[model samples]
Target: MNFSEIKLVVIDIDGTLLDNDRRLHPETMRVIEEVQKQGITVTLASGRTFISTARIARQLKIKAPIIAHGGAYIARVTDDEPLYEAPMDMNEARELVALLEASGYYVKVYIRDELYVQVVTEETLEFCSQHGIYYRVVGSGNLSELDKNPLKIVVIDTPQGINHVYKLLEPWKTKFNICRDTDRGVEIVKRNVNKGTAMEKVCAMLKVEKNQVMAFGNEGNDLDLIKNAGLGVAMGNAYAELKKYAAIVTRSNEDLGVAYVLEKYLLKNLN
Candidate 1:
């Protein structure tokens, strides 16, 4: 497909745009700016927090809506009011917390406006410090408080442990969607929240057709977006499942894959 026909380009950050060093390539930024100049709307759909996603959006100078928290939240880059949100129900949130705690995993609950951690473990504390995630530490004494509402539940653990948790919660898969972020962190959100759903909302708001959209991603969580977009571009280093869903495959993030695709497909065709 000729990417020039795409009016909106949705990209994932961690593994699609940023290299292993967690830095955006200069070429990628150039291509994004060129695409914007061509009047194509460029936005990010990621599993990251708005605060973190905003940093990259600012660097790319993207002014469109961003789908964050794996689509549980969608907000305009310059607006404070969320365009859409699909937070987990209170009971589901509590059950998730209980399950993680019982499995000996550290958990953090993300509410619409705040972040809550039942008890901060050494690993979780270090991860927060390194990632600059805003969070509050609530010891075991505050477990009862978890009955409050939540947007999603984030669990930090090894890949194996995460897989185990996924299996244990398999029965609830229909009620909630589970995904692993770039940091290997697992998250559970309301069933309706996902990159594809958020993209659909943004497209509707903009009056853009799905056939006019292009997307790039690199993880299992990105599968829906990739499969749904007209042109689903997968990073060469993307997960096997994600790559299978991609309509086209490009170089890895470190190789400036996003930029390569833009220039070769979107930019060149625009002119």
Candidate 2:
């Protein structure tokens, strides 16, 4: 493919841009700036909250819309208004909370744009700290205080515990979109929400075509975004399933894989 033909490059955080140590490589940021200088738009598509994603976007100096909440919400960094929001319905949120509670998994419910933890455990707190995420404690007795409207619900636990929660919620998969945000946790959003759908909205707003966009990712959740992009570049350390969906595969995140791919395919092709 001709990289010069590409107009937008959407990159995922975590495994795609940040190394396993959770730090963004300085080289990757430089390559992103190079691509922008070529008149190609660069944006972030992440499972992180808007607040978290915006911090990196600002550092990268990106002024475009961001696909956040695993594609459930898309908005520009300079504007608070969301171009699209696929929040989980109140009934669905309540039902999911009841089911997770019945299954005995300590979960965090995100409602009213706040993260509420059922019971703060050491592991959960560690996960939040490691990922630089913020949360508030709300014990079982305060479950009623969970926002009536929630964007999503997340269950944080060991891999085995999270697998158990997934099984327990299997019956409702058709009604909700369940995904593992990390090895230690799973996130549940509305069934219709996904990165691909959110990217499509951003493309429409920019008058860009799917054939003119490239995306990079390294997770199961990034599958749709990869499949939807004109050229899907997978990190070498990405899951095998996700790699299969990509048109090209580059080095692991720690090796500045995203930067390598952009330079080889996008930058090298530019005049």
Candidate 3:
């Protein structure tokens, strides 16, 4: 594909854009600004909350709409009401929480932008420490205690824990979107809420064609986004399952992979 046809750049946060320490590379930041000046829109799509994703966009100083909560939410870079949202059915969310707790896995419930847990466990702390997320302790048994429905739910444990939860939720897949977000984490959202679905809406709102989008991602949750984009870039650190679907594989996150490709292609356009 000719990279010059690209009009929108959709990026994932945790593994696609951020470094190992969860920070942006200066060169990456510079390249993004340059892309925007070239009339290309750079947007973020992540399993993270709208608040957290917005925080990253702010640091990048962008004002574009973002897909957050694994595509359960789409809004401008603010706390404003979403352009679109698909909250999980309350009963199903509670049931999944119960099943995960019964199986001895830690569950995180995301309502709008707030993260809640019965209590912070070692797994929760370790996961948050890696990404610098702040959460609240609900001090309850499960999501049954909350009257509000969540936009997304996350289960954290070993990679084996991912398979266990997948089997446990297999019957519920008809009602929710389930995918492994990391080696030790599985992300859940309402059915049809993955980034590919969200990207459709984003493309419409931005008035861009599917053949003009260039996306970058790293995890299993990113599968659909990678599959459907015009140019899907998988990081070298991405899983084999995801890499096979990429148009091309780039350097790893630690090596500023996203910026490397953009600078090469977008710069070529300049000269």
Candidate 4:
């Protein structure tokens, strides 16, 4: 890939940028700043909600529009308004939320900037805390009364738990898209919405060509984003499915994979 021709670099937040422990390496931070100084646009793209993604964007001092809610919501870090959004059909969301609740899966729904939960588990609390997402308890009865459609619904649980819930939703596969956000969590969005579509929108807004973008990710949710980018990188710890689509595989996030690539591939070509 021609690094000099790239103008945008999209980084996934959880498994790709932060280590399993949820810590951002100093070397990673330093390299990000260095790349920005050289005139590349760096943005955070993830399955997180806007409120959650914005906190990390603030910490990184990124002014770019962030891709959140598994690419269903894209918003500027500085404002509440979205650059783009594709919410699930209200009836579909209500039906899926009900099914997940019936199956005893912990479900969180993103409605605009707010998050609503059917039940708060320890897993829910930890996820909210990790992403700085604030949520309120809204049982099934109250969910239907909400005025807006949900950006997406996330089921948080152990791998087996999520898998069990995933199986129960098999009938809806033709209607909604379901994918794993993490080993323990599953995200559901409208069929046509995903990171790649969102990336296409972002590229259009930025007036950059698809061949001028670079992306880093490590899971199924990141597949399309990786495929559409000019140069796609997979973290060393990436899922096997994702690694197949990446042009390069870097060190694990814990090992500063992001930093290593920036220095060797990105920054080296800036001069």
Pick the lDDT winner: 3
Model 4 CA lDDT for position 231: 93
Better of 2 and 4 by TM-score: 4
Query: What overall lDDT, based on C-alpha atoms, would model 1 receive against the true structure?
Result: 0.82
Ranked by lDDT from best down, the candidates are 3, 4, 2, 1
lDDT head-to-head 2 vs 3, winner: 3
Supply the global lDDT for candidate 2. 0.83
| Cα lDDT of model 2 by residue, 74-138, tens digit | 88788878878888777767877877777777877765245677777887677667655778887
Tens digit per residue, CA lDDT, model 1, 1-271: 6565799999998888899888888878988998999999999998777777777898999998998888889998798879887877777667667767776777777765456777667766665664557778788635435756676777777788878777887888888998776445777788967898889889998899987999999987798898889889999999888888888899999899999988888877878
Worst 10 residues of 1 by lDDT: 140-149
Give the lDDT of residue 186 in candidate 3. 90
Give all candidates' CA lDDT scores.
Answer: 0.82, 0.83, 0.87, 0.85
Task: Summing lDDT over every window of 10 consecutive residues in candidate 4, give the lowest-scoring window.
Answer: 138-147
Model 3 residue runs over 4 Å out of place are 122-134
Stretches > 4 Å off in candidate 1: 121-126, 129-131, 141-144
Tens digits of lDDT, candidate 4, 66-160: 89988999989888689898888888788777767677666778887678876667876887777776788876546545667998888788898
- TM-score list, all predictions: 0.93, 0.93, 0.94, 0.94
